[model samples]
Target: MRTSANPIIADLRDRIQHLEGSVARHKAILPFGVPEIDAHLPGGGLAYGALHEFAGGGVGTVDGAAAALFAAGIAARTKGKVVWCLARPDLFAPALAQVGLHPDRVIYVEAIREEFVLESFEEALRFGGLGAVVGEVVRLPMKASRRLQLAAEGSGTIGLMIRRWRRPTEVGDFGHPTAAATRWRISVLPSEPLPVPGIGRARWLAELIRVKAGESADFVVGACDVQGRISLSSDTADGSGETRRSVHSG
Candidate 1:
């Protein structure tokens, strides 16, 4: 007797195999440069399919820029795919490049309106090809944040929400729901005295205000630039040393 071949069955089996491979690939998680922070987070780092928010207001612009640079460094170590969604078109490309992010690996999308910014952010997160997606938005509603969270979960990519502040209350209040895995507040620290002159070092105080896996409110992690890239500071070493090293980056 001759056997009959079913094309529908074969196609279904192929798709299932493909999906299984995808799931297996997603088991690997990306780690932020800070070990203490990563230890507090689920999966030892920022989970691939999760949304994280960076809140900034009292910190000022320098700290905000440092936060962006920090996220860029994390994305650079990834599979080399990143999308920077900004409300202003004139974002200093050179500044980002100075922080070790090659211009070629970055995609910049400029959206002037807040609504447009959030819409573009959602679209980029849904694209699924990027390793990480970052958005600088002034205000985001809980409903909208939930939608973005779902999109990130579906895409298996990291989503960074940098909340810009127009007023004092804007800094304290982020309208996101409980769905966010981690939330941070970043501010620039006063420059410490260095052995060498004319070369200034950057420092930031990152407060883990909300985290699902660990404690909530005021877990400060010191951050600084190491060889032009951002990483967590070493608690053992003094602020200024001839050689700089990152405490964690695995």
Candidate 2:
């Protein structure tokens, strides 16, 4: 014998179940520009509230510059808000603008030490309104990384750590424990236009060294125009009858 109130209670439960399923589906999709990389990331792109880390190659200046460009592009597309915490005062303004991220849209926090940088990063991640926060650090402790991860999750913001090492150490080696949902190693590749002169476009080989949710690690993607625009590379014969290789990746 069902009470008269039973039907109303069952109806409310069904509505709650439907809402839960909708939220789950929304959580499962993240959109990164590159189809290949998106395929590897857990939710397609970087999850809204997760930490991602990027380690520089042996060379700091070039690698750091590239990493900044990449992070800036992601932030620009995020459309919420972006913050960049730098330990070093010399962040190339022109280079950052070239990556499609307007300089005005960024908030820069200059920190004196690595610890301060990480601490600031955690605070920013916990703030809840930013679309993404980037911190430049040499190495992050596993515990600290986990805290940033959880903070990002709680606030619905993406956190990025750019690992910069001064000396030749295995700090950015292939396998390492990090709280980052995904980790990438970025290296500069020789630009195209072989046997020619002039500053050729920069090329990068991005490796998905560690991913919390993804398949395959080794993949190559080009860092197109610095301003975050994607361009295709073409090989065409110049009027001089010379076959030169041109590089383009958008």
Candidate 3:
């Protein structure tokens, strides 16, 4: 009998290695820092080197803006420059700052076509030193999504996909698989009713529609604190004085 050829021992070694790799991938996460939300995620945060998707509930509604801000706030938590591969010129820098993504740290790539946007996003994700990468697209095909996921894995950059649809019906396409680690849907909620009659901080219905690991969930959260950190609201009711400055940000 050969010395190192025992099938049982070899199988055990392979299984251990697979488990270790899976743990490593899930452990490198940037947490929301909110206990309520963190408890839902398997690793207590958003996974680095993985793609996450977010979209508005519908078109014509301002909820799309809310979704974009949520993604931006997550991106802001990254350490280096953020690559925003967008198709439009209408992104408001000041509004982004309100959610924690600063103007100076953003590297915007204005792509006129959806394909261009995806290409730019994948390229940026493959770049070794970036903090994060965000791309705007109405629909993300499975093939392109797989490539983006691989690029993020290779570079260790967090990827955020913000969906923007010209037609309201296209929002349904977001449910299709895209190899993303997590999927979120953001809808604008009425601001908190203050003690007085004035407007309170913005609130949002944040839904975790899909998760690669752990159970999916939802939250009625206020808004991001500075530097892209989220502060969750316990009740869906009144106000909390969070998500300051821009209502679109929440």
Using TM-score as the measure, the top candidate is 3
Compose the digit string of candidate 3's lDDT tens values, residues 143-209: 9999999888877789999999888679789867888988888988887567799877788888887
lDDT of 3 at 202: 84
TM-scores, in order shown? 0.75, 0.76, 0.84
lDDT of each: 0.68, 0.70, 0.82
Error of 1 at 185 (Å): 0.7
Candidates 1 and 3 compared: the better one by lDDT is: 3
Candidate 1's displacement at residue 80, Å, is 2.9
**TM-score-based ranking:** 3, 2, 1
Per-residue lDDT of 205 in model 3? 82
Worst 10 residues of 1 by lDDT: 241-250
lDDT at residue 191 of model 2 (Cα atoms): 64
Name model 2 segments beyond 4 Å from true: 1-30, 170-175, 194-200, 226-250
Task: Quickly count the clashes in candidate 3.
Answer: 2
